[model samples]
Target: MPLPRTAGSALLALALASVAVPASASSTAAAAADVRYVALGDSYASGTGAGSYSDIACTRSRNAYPALWADANDPAAFSFAACGGAKIPDVLADQVDELDEDTTLVSLSIGGNDSGFASTMLSCQYSTQSACERALRTAGEYVVNELPGELDSLYATVRARAPHAEVVIVGYPHLYKEGGLCLGGLSSAKRTAVNQGSDLLNETIAGRAAAAGFAFADGRPAFAGHEICTSDAWISGSNVHPTAEGHESAYLPAFSAAVSGN
Candidate 1:
């Protein structure tokens, strides 16, 4: 049975706290000799807010974390398959093919779009708190009720396609500090909700990754003190996508560590 939306947040928190999977650094690093890399996900993965776009349609950026990670590591083969507006279904249909038997590494930051996080943020930013609450509630329902099965199926597909690949599932960063003073215009209540929602999203991703035996990279700590609400914010204006620096400093390192197993 699908979990109630109201219980989703609590369940997600428990799941995140219980994660025991280590970072994929060493496992992926060892495979660097013949690595066939593929990067996948949504706007965050494509580097939407970071600018210096490589593809206008996908908003892929040369400075995006995936690009930077690839440059630093020098993988034998790399394909950036993530798109700005992708959901889990899009990945199953379009991006999964990028992973084949020879694929040595696959990293992705997904599930945010499946949860309608962008729309929830927009509703919160531009509309009433009640509207924001409603949007988030709906998103939470999707996270608990639908996202898990979708991720499980996707992971299975990837495993079937690339049995030898080391898969790293990256989670989103927290947009705001919980109850901290902030420069961003969002109200404290809104910020709290967003942070909580981000947690739920990350936990959902992490739990699924753990269950699938894929490494889960928690990006929250990487983004600590560099949230959209901070003076030296690494997240952009809407508190969603990362800035180039955020990708380089936070995401790049996190991904590198995950893949290199360092």
Candidate 2:
């Protein structure tokens, strides 16, 4: 499903507005004050299909995990720097200027795109199942073997910009389980491999983020056995995005993790 255009613009406008927050306010606040958060990363971070458009720019939706986190903060405390399709390079290149010394918490979900997961899924529509399987494995390899260095650099950049903040790296949701949900379309063997590969990707991400002294919010363990194919699914919207309830499943726990430093 396509994202709402109005939502994107609103978020962008909000980002521009946040650029000018008086540093004195964010910097000198009580240590226990609601954090000045900066949400960063890809589509999942933006809460695409998770809720209503947060009134800012072509970005931040009221229902977005970032905004949800902020709204539930007793007061709206964070400023979003997240965009639906952001890449590691984008974040490192000063694209999210809202991040600065005052940012108290930073949460981002990325790397899936870097592994070409979207395009691979698209290709699977036309290619043979075997080809898709290979692509999925390749995607896992890219995330595990190559994406870490990039993630390390991105995390370093954020930590450098906001030295006082506790960073949180949110991992992607599981895309499949053995045999999948598509009723006999894919073989059990293939589904098992796909899920296993996804595990590798998430493990790699969690390990790297841990090494960087950031909390890793892994959806794998929490959402395990509850992948899209399961009853009480943790993701919805035809496998691309989470349903409203799915958002709670993914982000609510993440929010708890953020508060608890998990």
Candidate 3:
């Protein structure tokens, strides 16, 4: 009862076609299809100065780094919960809800707002030198003494909510080039102090992120030549927030690299 030669060959081909796809190819496809992203934190994350506000109340900008990332990668889902003026408590209360066990990626830039960064900057720009110094001192103290605990709590909660997510803690940039010159802005001494504060903040945040097993995207190096007082500044003068160029050129690359394990 032997089959004819051509008929037997056709049966062999049919059996080969029924085999499952290779494991490597299947895993790659699953990874590509499972990117559920959630962005959380404050104005820096919300792209307040980058404009194109999607939510005016929260100042959520379409030019934000998270939005840019989502547009480029086209994640399975994206939740932009970062808001202007949000502090750690605010994020814990309002933003963490966006994450769940299904979330695969999360990124945020916070701690600056909680450190009274706005008030300190205003004092440096408009108030007396002594007053500015005092404000910087106060903010620095908070960053050292209080911000760590708050960050730890927030990071822990984020982990609990999105147990499988790859979390990235993005850091703030130095507002001014240390020795760069500008005719009518903060004094050299004030600029130096502000940059020091930024360094301290970034260090603290990076350390906490490491302890929590999260990636830290240090924005300082990326923004080095593009700070507020540069001839081609990436930060807006009005609120010290990153311009659209900054988000696209600086934050985007730094964040993208961190996510890619580079």
Candidate 4:
């Protein structure tokens, strides 16, 4: 549940809204001057489906995009605070403490789990049409109405913890290839609904990132030809998580560009 929209929360929201966009030149300079990088968020950031897991609980993987990026860049100080199945509250409790004034770069992919993505997909798979639609509707409502405030609070917490960090918010990818090449037993229409939901997710992330002056890394182009249902799909059969190839090929490049201020 979101915090009560009381006077305190309202003031916090205002302060957070002012932080949506960082000064590009200064952020770029800070990003280069020091490299105390931190990674935070949910399953995508935790490398759930990607192979070579490092921690079972967090599911940090050598192949996860964050780990790969850390390896390539060799940041002076790096903390991988993301965990499998993390929601906004989880990030607030477990991850934000990793940030500090010395932190320079941060990358995150969150809010999907909060939107009940896994449950919604299960409902779409096993429930009747009406039931699936209801589930999707609930998820969409959470994304539109509730997620922004939660994200705003979380972003504020991160910024306060590391005031100069060049934060990067990464968005989820479309899961389907369109047409009749649908994966699993989902109807084409259902696939389209799921993909649309993903678009909503990306749009929400992009908007919030812009509001906070953070860079938004889009995953769609990287996953373009390899969405689920295609022979070249980089996503795992689980559908909710990306495969190792997906992490390496899609998320890694997108995050690299974001870090480089491209």
Candidate 5:
């Protein structure tokens, strides 16, 4: 005999509830709930030119992408250990201590300082065209040869420490909008060289991150039209670091998307 209408309705509701949420969805939600995030790396990660510094010595800005993401997500725990002028050695020595088996997420942006980014930019800006070329060449060589070994080492250490963490390697943006006009920054040639160097560096980092089974968040596209020479530039007047708007709009979105696998 057929069931009563009320009994049939109850059975239908029970059947729908049983398959309402997929296993993958439930697993993802649980993983998100357990997130223990740690942000690491150099000045870019520390928000050097983004301002509102919480630590002047380290240039840890409250407006940095890590902080912004942490604020938005409300992770189970967050440790912002990134600092200005941090090279791979510095990160290995200090920042890695912040990670452990409990860490569920990690984000990093490094390798530029190791390539002498500041001096290269200074040479590009204040010195002759030849000097800019020389600086860019040296940085490019370092990125191609030496950076891979250093990045591999760093990624290994991070994996050992944060055994279960989802690592996200964030990349730098092209400093200038090529083929754009600007009053007083790097010349077109210098800007092109600098942008090329940024590309090489990001490519190297992305490769190493992939080798380590980590996610790589490319920040270049995020700052496409908002480069240093653009009318509405996202980079600070320093022409290197991103501005507050850049962090909020560019870095934050890139990182969040990477973490969420979106």
Candidate 6:
């Protein structure tokens, strides 16, 4: 796998220094390369509420994992087929021409929805209570049971669509950390439980991806300490999207790792 870019520590500096050179110079950096990249997932992959995309029509945006990977790699070489709030079936649904025969890389961050993670979180209302913790735990189990079949379908779909592509499935970032609750009076132990639940889903992602002949980027560790409720917030608005900086700091690592071919 390509490992996350340590060079990102220096990317902002390069972009800022290059800004004075004019549009043409920036255009050179933005130009597409000859690699095919495909992205499929929910809001984290959607770039929703991040205010970046080709346009509003697709509801898909530019800061999602695929676009971030593209910016790091050759732009022309990549394509973003990910849609916001997408489920495993949704990925199966989108007709990704870009994901077809020529794709060089593919990454997906999904399964949280199947776990009813969003619904659970919403019910907790960001509280810290016993009820909330149990909900998260239940949601996790749901995801564990559901993801394999869903992921198997996804893998088959990719194989049918992008036969030669190196498909990479990106796992979930930790959603809760340090006992911050979905509501009032929740235990920190539940925080650990919810995170563990999310981890279970990740393991499922890894297993299924492996079975289907695809690689999975290790995002949980990379995204550690940067959960949706993290002090620094790596996950974007709620349970869906990732912030622009969040993608840079969190999701981008997985993509970079895959591209590294390490």
Q: Clash pairs of candidate 3?
A: none
User: Scored by CA lDDT, what does every candidate get?
Assistant: 0.86, 0.70, 0.92, 0.86, 0.92, 0.69
lDDT of 2 by residue, 39-60 (tens): 7877777776565766344344
The Cα error of candidate 3 at residue 39, in Å, is 0.2
The segments of candidate 6 whose C-alpha lies over 4 angstroms from its true place after superposition are: 1-34, 55-59, 126-130, 179-187, 228-230, 236-240, 260-262
- Pairs in clash, predicted candidate 5: none
What digit string (tens of lDDT, one per residue) describes model 4 on residues 117-197? 899989988887777778888999888998988888888888899898899999898877777856455777777788888
Give the 10-residue window scoring lowest on summed lDDT in candidate 1.
18-27
Q: What's the lDDT of the predicted structure labeled candidate 5? A: 0.92
| Model 5 misplaced regions, further than 4 Å | 1-32
Q: Model 1: runs farther than 4 Å from truth?
A: 1-31, 180-184
Tell me model 4's lDDT, rounded to 2 decimals: 0.86
Report the lDDT tens digits of candidate 3 across residue range 1-262.
Answer: 9999999999998776655455666776677689999999999999999999999999999999999999988788999999999999899889999999999999989999899998999999998889889998999899999999999999999999999999999999999877756677888888898898899999999999999999999999989898877888999877799999999999999999999644
lDDT of residue 248 for candidate 6: 76
What stretches of model 2 exceed 4 Å from their correct place? 1-34, 55-59, 184-187, 237-239
Give per-model TM-scores: 0.85, 0.77, 0.89, 0.85, 0.89, 0.75
lDDT tens digits, residue span 77-151, model 1: 999999999988898889888989999899888888888877888998889888888888999989989989999
Query: Among all windows of ten consecutive residues in candidate 3, which has the lowest summed lDDT?
Result: 16-25
Distance from true location, Cα of 149 in model 4, Å: 0.9
Candidate 5 lDDT over residue span 48-135, tens digit each: 9888999999999999999999898878899999999999999999999999999999999999999999999999999999999999
Alpha-carbon RMSD to native, per candidate = 17.0, 15.0, 4.4, 16.7, 3.2, 11.2
- Which one wins on lDDT? 5
lDDT of 2 at 33: 77
